[model samples]
Target: MSSELLHDSGLIANPASTATLSDADADSLIAELALRGRAAQRVLAGMGEQVKADALRHAAAALRAAAPRVLAENARDLDKGRANGLAPAMLDRLKLDDARLDSIASALEAVANLPDPVGQVIDQRTVPTGLELSRVRVPIGLIGIIYESRPNVTADAAALCLRSGNAVLLRGGTEAVHSNHAIHAALVAGLEQAGVPADVVQLLPTQDRAAVGGMLRAAGLIDMIVPRGGKGLVARVQADARVPVLAHLDGICHTYVHSAADPVMARSVTLNAKMRRTGICGAMETLLIDASFPEASSVVAGLIDAGCELRGDARAQAIDPRIGKASAEDWDTEYLDSILSVAVVDGPEAALAHIARHSSGHTDAIITGDAAAAERFLTEVDSAIVMVNASTQFADGGEFGLGAEIGIATGRLHARGPVALEGLTTYKWQVRGTGQARA
Candidate 1:
């Protein structure tokens, strides 16, 4: 009933179209979103696995049916991004084509096929006094997701949240707002047809700066916030949120080449990690080579030959002047682009030392044939996901057999890895106690 609602109502005339949802209307919409989420979550939690599967199946169908419209909306975003001078890397992430739309729908189908994470009873036992204690997986209630300019994320996040029996609040970057909303329209249509609450998969109607502030601090409305963007946005949300956050602060990842590393595999994996998708969170930002490795020089040379612009410190720059001189900042940067920083370490100890000093604890990979060295790297890396002879990009949950992920959680406590279905829920202890009085 606010001025904002009138404004938003005007924008909704073209149901298939997307426009900025005003701030004045956002609070009321969010309130409705939270209420609907709570209700939908309750029903979903009680839903038979078959029913949930059916919903996912229908959602996939709806996504496929709406692909053309999704692509059209995405083009609008891409055109706007180009006009606004968005970086190529960012635009790549923002753009969505038919192939990407199909992939997003395929992911939903995959989620429909994965084992349901809900109704999973971890431990159940009866005590001597006839008290039954059971630990069961349950939905996390309501989830709030804030992500950057990836339109597929709109569908992926919503599907993952819904399948896990959690209601989701999605706030994507302003740049992809149009694409995100269009995709959400399909999601809502699927949910409604499946008899699920449209609010269960709500998108923020407004693109206001203050809306994020409000969502971050909506302690009662949101159960937790999942931030899936750059360090600045994640840090800002973390600082502002009263609600707990499942976050991947930064992917300042690395690939360390040991003395025993196979140069060819290391080079190929490193190239793919950095150049295949430079703007993704899992892209390797730093390349570390053992000082003692004879092929280390060749590996660095190979990277430079493969079109990587490497920056290094004095010791590293002395080896190759064609590579730029890396400053202290290079060691700590998450370039998220074509740029990569290089460092030379004496051995595994030095590699671990450097990683410990500079890693953001997102993803780190080691290339080594030696089992002992690989084991040491895996054990000592101290990241949410560690890899051996693989690109850090493999850290994604989908590659790890998770149908999809809300985001990768780099936090050390409770949730430290991929925010998949299991991560979307928490455990509850169901207790039934006999009549036993305290003495």
Candidate 2:
């Protein structure tokens, strides 16, 4: 598409000349964008549910229609990433194919189909002094999302925010700049088609890291910030952002095999959890085995047979001669690769302690048939998602039936796990009084 087309679609302001701009210039640009975002948010918050949902549906269709251009832009980013010597795992997250594009489009449609959270009554009550009161969902105003590599997030974040009656400002990683711009253009087209202000979703024009600092400092303009990437990016946003943040921390997830775990089930779940697309945040990084479990050796061998490199403690090493010795750091690492850390614990309590000490509080799973043990693990793990007899890989927004996720939050308070439509909202008190003055 031409520059004029993009501008008309409200995807860009002036796509002309800015190859060398100073940090101050980038900050000025971000500030300008934030002002536009705030204005758009006011318009969005008042929109009817059908209007927002229609916008999301149009955006989904636009993605399918613009697939060729989006793929062409993605190829440029992929070529650049390879040239930069990006790791295989990072490349997996960066790459986008036709099927993945279709999936992204489907996710948008699903979000559109979900019930709109805006203006929904959360609770209702009648006061003793005859006053009607209610808590109702409301938009969170403008949201700033800083993510890495995943160009799909550009679409997902925009759809979720728009459907929840919030405006969004997206800042994707430099590696996926071309892909982000292309996808964003399509989304803006959809918004315009549905009569929604295209400014409801904006992408930072430049890939300069300084723009991140600008967003972090936009305390008054942006309501909340979401950082969706590795530990370094999340740590920086959590530490420096002046605005309230919905932080997505490390996914040092674990899968524990209790003594009552069936060997066949344990083996199957562990393999799928660790090997099914290891690049995602939900991929299991550590494996905990009950020391007295008879099938520990079998489960360990199953993972090794599935092409996973095992770094094990002394007890686990004793079970398998080929298992490499795990360093102290292995337990706490989020290896978004084909690596797994193995440890042997006494039982449920020991497993819980190990996880409590090393877990990133993201997602953890237990493979056991015992009801009491499963309940204890579920209750005591202290992670955002605790699965029973299931693969940790199932720790996804789609799997949880939220359609798509901005990111998996490991933080306490506000939001935890997959942050979808409801997670993007805050509430307000709505009271109806018949001109009665309180004493």
Candidate 3:
């Protein structure tokens, strides 16, 4: 189906005034999308696992078939972004090639292959009153996702939500509007082919910022809001959204090299943690070394040699004259680039102290061979994900074997870490009783 047909079919709102939309118009559009989404979610909830899996597999095939068109749309966005002087990192996230399209499709297929999370019995037992009580997973109903750049999120978020039996409403950034529309069309075509409701996944058809406010204020319609973008976007959604939010905040992650860490292992893991696709949220932003560790210089030298710009505290700077001075703010910054902040700590306690002060509670890693120190670090760090003897870059949904993620949630409430199919679901109690009375 064409993007226009999808818009007209009520899968998406009609393209609104891009320049400005009155509060009433924006509210009407948001309401229309939400109503459609709720209806779609009801249909999706009734679908069996096989039916949903077939739809995802069909969507994967459609994405592969529509690769050329998707790439073309992405190119147009890239050109405009360049003209608008988007940063290199932002452009990297915005740009999509054939390989990325293929990966997105593959991720959808992977999600289909995983066992469906909906309807799964979490726990069941018989109460003393002869009441059978059980909790079964269910969809969160209509989910509103507001993201920036990374057009692939259109497909990933849709696939995860559909597989988990929830409807999704996507609001992608203006930078990738064309790409998002193109991808959404392909997904809708797949849904149609599989005999599923196309409205199961819809994109807001306008780029006006007001659309976001509408989604945020959609209270009863949008069950939850997942913001996948920069700190500013996440902050706005968290601050203004009336709906519950699954926030993806800054990845000011830290990699601490304890005194027991192997020098070679530390060098290898640190390089990959910082330089392996530095634009991703899993990338390590800060490096901590125990002052008692004798091999800190080797690891520092390896990073500098690998073309990673190092901004270090006074002690770290004293370790290497070539290391640039890092301000207090640098420790808290998420430089989604080739830059890294370095610090030297007294020991595991000091490292923990530093991380507690500056870490974003996203992902923090400790590289140590000492079992006790590793355990201590793991227990002490309050981040959603903490790694011991592993690179912080492994903090990913796909790497964690959950297929693809909507985003890595930093919040400690209902869900944390990589939000995959299971994260999309909430549970409800089912009580069965022949005869029961409250005494």
Worst 10 residues of 3 by lDDT: 8-17
Shift of residue 180 alpha carbon in model 1, Å: 0.6
lDDT tens per residue, model 1, 1-439: 2435635665344433344455544556666667777887777777778777777778888888998888888888899899999998899999888888889989988988888878799899998778899999988889998988988888889888888888888888988988988889887887788777676787776666666776876788899889888878999998888899887888899999898988788778888888888988899999998886667666777778877899987677877778898888888988878899998888999999999999999899999989999999999889999999998888788998998877888888767778788888889999888787656
Candidate 1 stretches greater than 4 Å from native? 1-26
Alpha-carbon local distance difference test for all models: 0.83, 0.89, 0.91
TM-score of each: 0.94, 0.95, 0.96
Per-residue lDDT of candidate 3, residues 147-254 (tens digit): 999998999999999999999999999888889999999999998899899999999977878879999999999999999999899989999999999999999999
Q: List the residue pairs that clash in candidate 2.
A: none
RMSD of 2: 3.2
lDDT of 1: 0.83
Query: Candidate 1, residue 232: CA error in Å?
Result: 1.7
If both were scored by TM-score, which would come out higher, candidate 2 or candidate 3? 3
Model 3: clashing residue pairs? Answer: none
Number of the candidate with higher TM-score, 1 or 2? 2
- Give candidates' CA RMSD values in order: 2.4, 3.2, 2.7
